[model samples]
Target: MKAVVIGGGIAGLLAARVLTESFDDVVVLERDKLSDEPEYRAGVPQGRHVHGLLVRGGEIMEGLFPGLRDELVRSGAHLMDAGEMRILNPLGWVASGRSGMPLLVVSRPLLETHIRRRVTAKIVDDAHVTGLTFRGSTVDGVLTRDGRIDADLVVDASGRSSKLPAWLAEAGIAVPEPEVVDSRTGYATRLYTAPPEIPVVVAESLSAPDTPRGGIVMRIEGDRVMVTAQGAGGDHPPRDPEGFQQFLDSLRGPIAGMLADAEPVTPVYLFARTASRRIAFEQVTGWPGGLVAIGDAVCVFNPVYGQGMTVAAMAALLFRRHSDFSAKGCRDFQRKVAKTAQGSWVLSSNADQSWAGVEKTPAPLMRAFRWYMKKWQVALVHDQDIFLRFLRVVHLVASPATLMNPVVFRRLAKYSRLDPRPGRRRAARSPR
Candidate 1:
């Protein structure tokens, strides 16, 4: 069978790579003129920001491209044990513990190009897929600007800006209406030089309550560190030199101090239109035969959580699990892929909802639970087990349900009483 993958981003490449293992021919059509070197383009605007390959993605990527982690490390991406990394939550500084998994930090562009180069599929750059060239209802091939190429299947990995839906409608198929959860967020990222000879320290600092700000400092391929400071709900960080530093200083922890001391490399890169969006492709009726969508094309999350590429990579794994890649397979594949994407989707949704000005308020019980969790987050500062469970959930290794278990509740109760609030001093009885 032949497979034509539209869009050569991480998702498309992953789809093509996996398809190659099962199909005779796989062609990837990328709209942008892909560079042999690592660089950003107009198509992928998120490249300018900090991107992380979560521990889950790292495992899948290595399976797809052997020695990928080592190559990434050789190219300059640092591997920091996610549990050992410094994280400042709304509560306080929680001590890092061993989760036996680490995250690979690299520039978004490098990660894409690295995966693209490794895939052996025929990549046609500077090609826009105009539409689909189908016979009756079965998709036989794609309609590119140049001409048509026959294929057994087509995968739409075109990202959140994908035109596949319009192309499908033009082909006389029902276009899927996606559900979106928009949280008007913005980000300002700048590259800085790490102080002389200091090993890169990956740090994430959160801005709580009054300020919905967060930032990440990690060493990428170059000898420089990438620092991204982001604010939600229209609280844009200024591009001016002094204001940027002030924004950093307002963060929860030592990141502001580190940035205050570190030298600047790249100018502050600011990005906006950061919203959580999910395309419910599975709900669409008679979607299409021999065609499927993956990656940000299916779901685009707020970049604040850094799950875009990882979730996309995970989607590829789901796609590969399906034995069939035909028309019925495409629809079935979407339903199956939803299960894999649901975890990260819920993870990001909950975190995004934490900020003020977020439109979608949870139910009364959930709102109360979030308030209680906030207190637990504060209590987690002195509780190692709570901290570990929180990190595990954030990393996607564990579910959000794990945190609500009775054992975790008992631990939190003990910590809350022992380390009472600044003004109050009371001990609550432990749960039986």
Candidate 2:
């Protein structure tokens, strides 16, 4: 069997890698010209920004491509314990300790390059997939500028810009309107040579409702660090160097002072498309056979939560586990994919609701959840166990329900008296 995967990005490459195990031939179609070396491409506009491989994501990728973590470290990527990273939440700084979760800090291009190199499938660059080719009710292939490429199966990993919905509509399939929640988040990022004086490996001050500004500084490959200044609820970081630095200085953390004298290696790059959107393909009537969508094609999360890549990895793993390719089987797989994304969608969309100007008001349950989460953040400040549980949930290693355990409820009740004011902590003095 032949499988055609559209978009040679991380999702597409990963899907192709998984397809190689079952399909006799697998081909990936990417619009941009991919190079052997790690470099930014136009297709991934946010490639220059700071990216994190969650502990669960790293574990999944390592399983798909063994020794991937070691290879990255060998190429200068930093492998550090996740708990060591300094994080300023809405309340205060989370206590630091070893959480047993390993974080692999690497550039997007580097990670993509390594994954692409490991994939045994054929990857065709500069190939633009316009639409799908249907054999009656089943999607048999994809249409490209060159010609029709037939396949027994077609996987859509075209990301947020995917045209699968339109293609299905044209084929008389009724697709449901995608659920969307936007916080109007924007990012301005720049790369800098790692200065000897900078002692932090990864530091972040997350944006909150009261304080819309946030910043992150993390070490990546090439002995360099990436600094991203971000804002939410329409407070966007400026693209100009002076303005960018000023924005950094406005953050609640010490990232600005840490990078005060660092030499910049790249110009400021701005990315503003951080909305959370989910296409409910499983809800569509008459879903086509021999077709599946993964990654951003199905759901796109706010990059601020650092959930997109991890969710994509989880979806690809779901695809790998699915064995049936019949019409009903395809529908079942799509439903499974949707189920897998539900947790992340909840985490990110609910968080975005905290920003001002969001149209969607939280339900009573969500409101209570948010209230509890605020107390949980306060608890995280001095409780290493709570911090580790939060880390595990965010990393996709544990269920969100774990945070609602009786132990956590008791902890929150204890910390309830210490209702730390939001965004009131003094600027972080130094990285832990």
Candidate 3:
């Protein structure tokens, strides 16, 4: 059996790696020349932005590539204790502390470079995949600019601008309408020659109504720092140095001040195409077999949330679990891939949709859910237990369902608004 993967970014490399287990031959067709140097691969527009590997994502990657964490550290990746990172949210800030989950902080390119080296598959770089070669619903192989590379299965790990849908339509397959939520968000990132003493992650992401922006400064590999300024809902970050500094200064807290003295080493990189997009492949009646899509090819979240890489890892794992690419098996895997994305979709889109300029309004239930989360955020500021739960859910270590459980519900009840009106204290209600 043979498998061919399109696009050689992190998702495609991981998918190709996973296929090596079940297929006799696995080929990764990449449009960009896969360079040995630790730098951004072409076609990955967001590769220059800030990225994080969630706790669960770290575990899965390590399992797939053993000693990969140590290898990353040896190559200057910061093995961060997620619990110890500082997070400044609109409701309140989470002070640096310790937790059980570890985060591997590295640049997207460096991480991908190492993974690609370990993939052990036949990597054909500079080979652009034009479309799929179909034989009655089952993809027989791919059509590249060079020639046809036949395979039993073809996996689309291509990023957001995937042409797979068009290719599929040509092959007589129709996918469902995509769900999209645009916040008009943008980000500006610049690399600084800061020494290695920087925090593993310095993030300020909180979705209070009308708060349209945030920022972060974290250490990536190579002993340098990446400072990213975020803007949403018509508040776009500037791409020039002076304007970028002003935008950073406008952030909610002191992260901007932290970089006032750091020496910059790269030009400011701007990315404004941050939108939440998802396609329900399982909903497509008679979804084609021998073909599957993962990563940004399936769902692309706002990069500010740092959910893409983690979600891609989970999807690759899901593909491995279902192994076969037969009609029924493909359906089952697509549904599971959609299911794996539900948590991130709910978490990111709900927050992005809350922005003032974002057109889509949350449903009544979603609004109520965010209200509960706002209260929970306030609770998380003071209660370690609540904060830990928040950490787990955000890192994908635990399900969002845990937040609505009785234990958490009771805790949130204590932090409800206590009428700040003069001389009047609303009766304090106990948990039901």
Candidate 4:
């Protein structure tokens, strides 16, 4: 069997790696030459920002490439027990305890390099995949600059700029109507020397309705810390030193002071194209066979939430189960992968809609759910067990059902009397 993968980003590399295990031959075609070192490339615009490998994503990566976690640690990435990290939510300090899962903090480029090294397939660089070449109802191959590369299966792991839907339309297939949710958000990021006093992963502040400003500082590879500040709507972070420090100061408390003291390593970098978009490929009818799409190509989320790469890994793992590297493989794979992405998509989209100035109102259920979640957040800050349960769902290690269990519901009920006024201040001090 022969499998062809387009795009060399995390999703593409992951899918190709899995393909190598099952197919007789696997090839990856990338428009950009991949880097042996950790650096930004044109294909990935958000590479400069902080990226957290959730426990679930880290576990999946370790399963696919054994010893990868240890290798990453040796490479200077921080292996952090999630329990030790401090999170400041709207309610108060979420007490630290064993979270039952661990998170890995590393630069995005380094993580991509690690995956690229694990997948030993034939990589054709500077090869632009122009279109999908189909024969009748099944996809036969892809047309690139060099010509067609026929394959039994073709997976489009291309990132947010993927033109797969248009290519499909050119092949006489109806492109699915994508569910688009836009949150006009921006982020300013920079590298800093970690404070000698701070030793673990810390999420200083997360945006809430009252104060929609958040920032993170974590120990990444090379003993450096990556700090990112995010703002909603058009509330962009300033690039100048004074303005930048004020922007940090605007986010609740303490983190700004801590960051100001940390030595700066890189200039402040700003990025804005943060929107939540999900394509409904599964809902489309008469989809052809032998072609599939994965990763951000299927659903691109707000990067501030950090769901893109982790869910991409989970979706690729789902595709591996349904993949057959045959004529009907693409269609079958899409059907299954769509199911896998639905839960994460809903989780992220709803979260993105919770903010103001997102230009759209949350669904009725989403609005109510957020209201209920806020109450739970207040309770969880005081209850360690409840906090862990909520953290499990937020990290994608567990579903929303876990948040509704009898034990958690009991806690929420007990803490309902402590609910603050609906419009009260939501920001709190750092849990650390």
Candidate 5:
């Protein structure tokens, strides 16, 4: 069997790697030229920004490509326990300790380079896929600039700019409109020489209404730290250095102070396409066979939550588990991929809805859930157990439902009475 995967990004590379197990031959088609070194390319504009390989994502990638974690660490990626990182949420700072969940802090380019090296598949760079080749109702191959490449299965792992919907529409397959919840979030990132005593990840969480700005200082590969200033609801960070520093200073944490004397190594790069979008291809009654879409081709989350890579990894894993090349099999796999993205979509969209300029209002149940989450955030400040659960959920290791367990529910009930004021003040430091 032959599988053709479009886009040689993290999603495409991982999908190609997984397809190698099921298909006799797997080929990846990338529009941009693949570089030997970890250099930024035009295809991935967000490659210059900060990216995190969450604990669950790290585990999945390591399982797919063995020794991946150690290799990343050797290549200058920081491997640290997630809890050791200092996190300044809207409520207060989360206690620093060992949570037993390991995180790999690496840049997009370096991580993609290492994964591309490990993928045992034929990757054809500059093979721009324009459309799909159909054998009657089933998609048999892809139409590229060079020629038609036949495949038993075609996987669309393209990023946010995927043209699968348009291609499908041309083939008479009507797809549903994608669900979107955009908070107008924007990011400004610059690489700085790491100070001697900087934390692995120092982040100030963005809350809605009052605090629309946030920032993070993450230690990545090459002895450098990436400082990203983020804003939502039209309060975007500026591209200029002076304006960026002022925005950082406006954040609730010590991010600005930590980078007071640090020397910048790169110019500030701005990324503003941070909307939560999901297309329900599985819901299409006339969905074609021998084709599947994963990663940003299906759903995209707010970058502030850092869920894109991990969710892409999860979708690839789902693809591997449901590896059947038949018509019904492709439809089933797409459905599973949609299911995988649903949780992250809800989490990201719910948070975005809390912002001021967001048009969508939360339903009654979601409003209640958000209310409970606010209380849960307060509990995270004083309760380590609750914080660990929250960490697991955020890492995609556990379901969000786990946060409503009796233990967490009782804690929320207990902390519900505490003042839920928004600011930098550490509300009720006592562990009562």
Candidate 6:
């Protein structure tokens, strides 16, 4: 069987890698010129921002590619435990001990390039995909500007700017409306030389209700730390250095102190589109078979949550599990992938909605969950076991349902009464 994967980013590479196991031939179509080295491009605008392979994301990639993490480490990416990182969350400072999630701190382009090298699919960069070729209702292949490439299976791993809706509509198929939950958050990132004594990653969650902002400083390869300062509702992070410092100073913790006198390596890069979008592809009437959409093409979460790459890996896992290529099979895969994304969707949606000016109404269940989680975050500060479990959920290593256990709830209730605010340790503790 032949398979064609559109948008040769991480999602497409991983999908092609998996498809190579079953298909006789696989073609990866990319719009940008894929580079051998880690660098910039027009296709992945958000790739310039800081990215981390959340525990499960790294594990999923490792399972699929085998030794990819080691390659990243050898090539300069850092594979450290999340415990070594310092996090200042909304409730308070979380005490770090065991790094439960196998975290990989690396730039997006480097990761993409490494994965691209491993996948056996023939990648056609600079190939602009126009639409799909349909045989009755099944997608027989993809139609690019140059010519048509026939395939038995078509996987749309294109990022958020996917042409799926337009193609589906052009083919006389019903296009699914995207469900958008946006906080209108924006952030600016600048690269600086790694500080003398900085943790591999520092996630300072300015989760306070009045001034909800976020900041992250991650040590990537090439002895540099990428810092991202974010704000919501048009409250964007500044692009200038002096103003960027001001944004850093306003955080719950003063990362400015750590960045004190650090040499700037790159100018600030701004990314403002922080909306959570999901397409109900499964619910689309007369949905065609032999085609499936993955990655940001199907669902786009707030980048602050860092679930984008992880969820993409999870989608690859989903494809591997239900290895069916027929129309009914592909349609079933699309719906199942959405079902898998529900937990991750809720995790980020709850966080982004915590800020003001976010107009989306929370579901009754999410409303109740947020109410309980407010205390849970506070409890997380004082309790290590709860913190670990919560981290597991955030990392996609465990189910969100685990947090609802009666025993866990009882503990949270006890902590809730004792410490209403939850994060007991607000002061920054230098990494051990």
Return whichever of 2 and 6 wins on TM-score. Answer: 2
lDDT of 1 by residue, 281-366 (tens): 78777776787888888888888887887788888877567867656777788887787789888767766676666655578876
Off by over 4 Å in 1: 197-209, 416-432
The per-candidate count of clashes, in order, stands at 1, 0, 0, 0, 0, 2
Q: Model 5, residue 294: what's the lDDT? A: 94
By TM-score, how accurate is candidate 5?
A: 0.97
Candidate with more favorable, higher TM-score: 3 or 6: 6
Candidate 2 lDDT, 1-432, residue by residue in tens: 999999998889888888899899999999999899999999999899988788888999999999999999998788888887878776667887898888888889999999999999999999999899888878899999999999999999999899999988888898999888999999999999998766445455554577788878888888788888888999999999999988887776778888767899999999999999998898777888899999999999989888888888888887667878767888999999899899999988888877878855778998897787778778888798888888899899999989877998887788889856776655657435
How do the residues 1-432 of candidate 4 rate in per-residue lDDT, one tens digit apiece?
A: 888999999989888888887889999988987778887888988888878677888888999999998888899887877766787765566766887687888889888898888888888878999998877778889998888999878889988999988997887778767777666678888888887776556564444456567778777887788888877756778777667778887765457777656888889888888887878776656677777889988888888777888888887786556746443555667767777777777776776676676646566887788878777767867888887787787788888788777777788889888864432343554645
Residue 144 CA displacement from its true place in model 5, Å? 0.9
Q: What TM-score number comes out for model 1?
A: 0.91
lDDT of the candidates, in the order given: 0.76, 0.86, 0.81, 0.78, 0.86, 0.83
Q: Distance (Å) between predicted and true CA of 156, model 6?
A: 0.8
**In model 6, which runs have C-alpha deviations exceeding 4 angstroms?**
360-364, 418-432
Model 5 segments more than 4 A misplaced: 424-432
Q: Clashing residue pairs in candidate 6, if any?
A: 289-327, 378-422
Return the lDDT, model 1, position 373: 65
Q: Residue 395 in model 6: shift from native, Å?
A: 0.5
Better of 2 and 4 by lDDT: 2
Local accuracy of candidate 5 as per-residue lDDT tens digits, 212-303: 88888888888999999999899999999999888887776778888877899989999999888999988887777899999999998888
1 or 5, greater by TM-score: 5
TM-score per prediction, in order, is 0.91, 0.97, 0.94, 0.94, 0.97, 0.95
lDDT per residue as tens, model 6, 61-178: 8998899999999988987777657777765667666855678889998898888888888999999999899999899999898999998989999999998999999888787678
